[model samples]
Target: MANTMTSYTDAQIMKALLTKDFSGIGREFVDDVITSVKVGAFTGAQNLDKVSLPSVKEVHYCAFQNAAITTLDLPWGELEAIGFSAFAGASGLPQNPVFSKLTALSNGAFAGTSDKKNTDLRTISLPLWTGSSFSEGSGFSNSTGGIFAYCTALTSVSAPELQSLPTQMLYYCQALEEVVFPKVSTVNSGAFNYCSNLKKIDLGGAITRLGSAFMANASKVTALILRGVTTVPTLGSTTFNSTAVKSGNCYVYVPKALEATFKVASNWSTYASQIRAIEDYPDICGS
Candidate 1:
């Protein structure tokens, strides 16, 4: 009589891998099967030049680390979170993956990579982040770390639900021209430290704490409009003193009710001549 052998189906093997069960399957058997399946799936897929994973709703940590994926087109609108160190050291992938649908990024989501050279990643629309904690050096760093760093063409950003501005979010975006933080309530330190060309900053009536060096060394900021601010904190001896505020030439506007409070602050008092109640100057462009 001829000898007989048992065979397992692909679904059975995949289920075993997912459950981490190797009772009947040998270690080599599992490894060989997984490797072959992955290779075949990647090679047989359509559009090998531009692989688009639209069905992937969530990506865990190190999901694609050290892989050969050169380009990723993640356009899934349902993607809500990216695990920590998810794309860390993914040298083969582009610096900026086109994700027109990604809404949230966990801590260190794209950390530890030296492949950001000549990357054109300028503008991002994070409209869903209501309250998020970005630790010190927890977010993007390095020359390629700024949220919109080196994006020479980036001119404007509109986020209606953004409650806090993370530290170093716009660290070295030298070409940023305008930023509209309509709902921003808190601004951490060094938020816009080295933006040399930043010209217009419109902080709408919701900000409370302006951390140290919030806009330090941003000489090009010609207009600062604080529509509902009651106080401007001091940064050591320098305070909020800039050529724009010291010359008494730059325009400063405040709410009508907070005129007394604004006139009492030492930083604002020096530029008192430049301050005007918002109601009095309805037509002024820079407030």
Candidate 2:
């Protein structure tokens, strides 16, 4: 199936989207990598090299569920949101969902946070994605763990705009080594559950809440940095029970001025001995 030139109008794209039929869009290219192409509503069967959606504001659910395009050119300047499962499947997209342009995502466009469960034939399903790496996912404010959950190959995350971590955000991503959330204040339930390789977290002063099992099974984390937080943030049950403590050296960093406050703050008292003041160490997030 070689697609030479059958340009589709925006109306045709929407029509194909509404009807879920993409016969009008010339299907497939032998190279499987496009230099530059513009259109929408790709049937999961097509192989594309590049896709550029310039005028699109919203990508409805499952629009490009399984197109084998190697490049994704989302209309970052104009796109507002992407519905759930908009790009599901292990190979649906060539890269991770690190939207480098979601600063304009003002209306809370979640981008269809997909899981590993959907069995629809429209999207290609496979085992774990081993090549995925984590970067600063920009332009998104989703509060669901579906963003990068279950990616066995994910190693690090550096989301500067994230103020809160959604439930099960990185659940079971055992390869995670570092997480840098400069502004994250809230951590929902099961946020980092079962991530065995996570070594450190630098939660700058803005943190306020830690939900249950947020770091449930992350056993190798040796450091937890909260050097900027003055007040003891709220803690849920077993926040770091089997996860960090299993390493026997999980150090919790806090401001020296308020070290006493964190030591006795309800559930925090459980790790009172592990708490240390950030003022005492310059290279804290690592140690």
Candidate 3:
């Protein structure tokens, strides 16, 4: 039964949300004060497998942290932000959930693992993303987790318009295998940390700088395609120190004319043995 007695105190509202009963809560009340889902409102709502999100613009902290949400009619264009741990423990979301116009995602916004899986690029979009790292420049610090950390089912991602990747963007996504960022110029620190299955990175012509620990502990990365990058990226001693790229086991495929340049560049020179002209890998990276 809907709690029809409308006037509610702070404690009463908390009790109503905790009980998972919002039936008779009139739309007027919802639109005026509950525009956003209250924090921790549905944290463990196991029966909440589908969400009706048309009236909601934002989801507050831990609102549905561990809910059984498998489907939602989310207004992607109108939804602006999702709070920290909003869907952290929900393991039933689709592998390719579209975020058409979303602008902000707090730490661990969708952190937990899920059973739904796939390799879809448009699953997450950031054409309107304007948030910066909460732990900016402090690459490996655990202070801020990525929007999709520990998402084991997500296998791939491609953000063609993104220029810079924040720290730990896809940290510990064990199933992630490929990344396509044609216009990305700077991949920040620890962006792909511990992604064990990651093998291909197509930075194309735009990448200029790779931050500290950019691909740390990503041992499966065997293909680094910089098709038109004429200038070697700024590489420090530990830029790729912990990845397969630094150990001479992977191939750094660059434009044919710049093969020599990469082989002789600063830290890149150290991997001269692994540097190769893109033309030679026509079967793998195309001509």
Candidate 4:
């Protein structure tokens, strides 16, 4: 095929979508022509990409399993919510859903909250995401496991605008390596559970609650930096788990004035032997 671009009527697109056929569509379609997409419409197509619907305001329950979509660009200004498993099995996808202008998302819209059946894509970089929480019942809670539980290739997450994290958001992502959440203040349990490759984390001071946030059995963490947070959040029994102490290389750095406070807190005090003041480690910020 020439991979050409052409016009498609709403009726024609709807027909192909309902039949699970893309034989009449092109690799790139114009968004201005598409107004709506039905639930489970594009479930198993193999060659879809570049769906430009600048006028579309919402997309309800759709699937794109094993599709060739690379670099998604949605009409963020009008997009309200995306329903379950929109990109469930697209293993080739290298980046997370890019909600450039949209603000809201629904349950299981990106990946399953409990099972590994729908999430084969890797990486979750919500660059423009700015919210305290996500729709809980939407994805993460419906499944028996975490949202990224089966995303074995997933390696990084960068959500700078978010202040809090959902529970088990990245559970069992064994290959995960780097995380950058500079604005996050709170995190739910098992948020980073079983992320074996993660090495370091840089969290902001607004943090007030933590629920087994960074528990792991094979953790490779060596540096943990908390910037200016005063009152320690509620720490889970396994929040630090095996990461709190390493041979002699691991260090937890807090504000210069609050080192004493951290060393005396309940769960945090358990790692007091490894905790230190930020001034003690001038290189904590990697300046």
Candidate 5:
């Protein structure tokens, strides 16, 4: 049942949202009033994207189980956190919404979507998350056993602000072919579990930890560049498990001066068969 009240204060607005009574409520009501939207507020809304709340600077744990949202226009600068499964099961969302100013995202924030054919979105771009950190089971997880298991059409990602990735961060994005994570440091288990199409991964020199990070995507990865890195991280028991690339088939490029050092390092010695000097591959490491 929807509330038909014509007038609503912020408290009433919060109540109306929590109770699923959005009768006379519209964008005008929100833009004219509501300044912050927190968790448990938009737990189950039907059509909120129709309204653009320029006045709202913070949106957290909103838009849960909603089936009819096509566009969301929020003031990202004023935004704080997008809690767990905030927009899960919103299968009809066509493209990735822009969140240029968001700082934090909890697990599975936008994970499970509807299984309707043609409903699978193509891309998700987060251009501004300079100070953000993604917790476990977050980013994009298909909690329902591959129902929304992967963003098959997702080919590009630009998350330079990411400092670390929790478990299964981009676990099953099979068609993902491009990624740009310039400052990532720690990678937990299953971080890029089955990204079969991403052929190259550059963990830059700042990487110091790898927690079973890449167990299954090793075959498709033709190049593994860890430039400027001098030390090897604590490798998991299955750090390079079940990789199809035979010895000499794939290349692991380390800093030129550290090539020999890596070959003799613990855990790294497992991939010594595929190891090479970074300078050997000018395409990846400029001469």
Candidate 6:
């Protein structure tokens, strides 16, 4: 007697694949033993390495948790919202080689240590990210939850359109030397906690807030340029204590409009001489 399980309908197979229903008959159905998988009835699997997802138009939770996906290339799309731990522990995908296409990433979309072993990623470009996570001092700060935390080979991040940085986004990228922030509006706490090699931080005129410990423990950052910042919060004590900001060895350039504010602030007064109201100067990182 031979095994005689009935074949599933195409609609059923498709539903299983889209939902990741890897159980019982569903598993055997997608094993490709008898039929090929399809996306929304489309049958060609060749050149399908990149799959486009429907724009999540509403607030949803855990959209893709523990998924087996290897890469994602979202095009001119917007994620309305994401639940906590949306992309947590996706251990199968490799480091993204081209991240410029991603316009937005929801909170905790790529959180946790699931993919820490695959650290070959070197470059990233997100042009439209505006969330606080994009701010160098927010929750996405280098010492806290940055995706590339401890990724020593990362050299540069060119996000000219990013408006904010979550805390600790690039906290300990030891090899990072240069960064270009175009439309940044805020830098939150612990943004670049211990990036020892970061030498230059150029902020456009949109920034308004500077959080606590924004550049703490970065000994190599010698020069800083602030053009559009108007409200300079108290530069927290012990923050930058280990870096050039400690012994008044680093040069801090501020717009003339902010010269008075820096001079008045008690925390900034100590370094007032090092802080100059200048328009331009040589590259901070010796590039």
Instruction: Report RMSD (Å) for each prediction in the order shown.
Output: 9.8, 8.4, 5.8, 5.1, 5.6, 8.7
TM-score of each: 0.62, 0.69, 0.73, 0.73, 0.75, 0.63
Residue-wise C-alpha lDDT for candidate 6, range 84-152, written one tens digit per residue: 334444333335444434544544444444334224446655554555232223433222145445555
- Expressed as tens digits, the lDDT of each residue in 1-287 for candidate 1 is 11122355566545444543433333212122111112122211221233345445655544443333445555434566555445544333443343444555544344332334223344556566553422224333212123433333344455667767766566656667778787776777767776678876766745565676677667777666677565654423353555455544455566778776766776557666676677786655443
Candidate closest to the true structure, highest lDDT: 3
Worst ten in a row by lDDT for model 6: 36-45
List, residue by residue over 18-40, the lDDT tens digit for candidate 4.
66555567654555545555555
As for model 2, its CA RMSD to the true structure in angstroms is: 8.4
Give me the candidate number with maximum TM-score. 5
Please report, as a residue range, the 10-residue window in candidate 4 with the lowest summed lDDT.
Answer: 136-145
168-242: candidate 3 lDDT, tens digit per residue: 878888887888777666677888898899998777645777789988899999998887576888888888788
Better structure of 1 and 6 per TM-score: 6
Query: Which sections of candidate 5 miss by over 4 Å?
Result: 1-32, 47-49, 62-67, 76-78, 91-98, 113-149, 213-218, 244-249, 285-287
Off by over 4 Å in 6: 1-84, 92-103, 111-120, 132-153, 231-233, 280-287
Better of 1 and 4 by lDDT: 4
The full ranking of all candidates by lDDT, starting with the best, is: 3, 4, 5, 2, 6, 1
Single out the weakest 10-residue window by summed lDDT for candidate 5: 140-149
Report the number of backbone clashes for model 5. 2
Higher-TM-score candidate among 3 and 6?
A: 3
Model 4 lDDT, full chain set? 0.59
Best-to-worst order by TM-score is 5, 3, 4, 2, 6, 1
**lDDT of all the models against the reference?**
0.51, 0.56, 0.67, 0.59, 0.58, 0.53
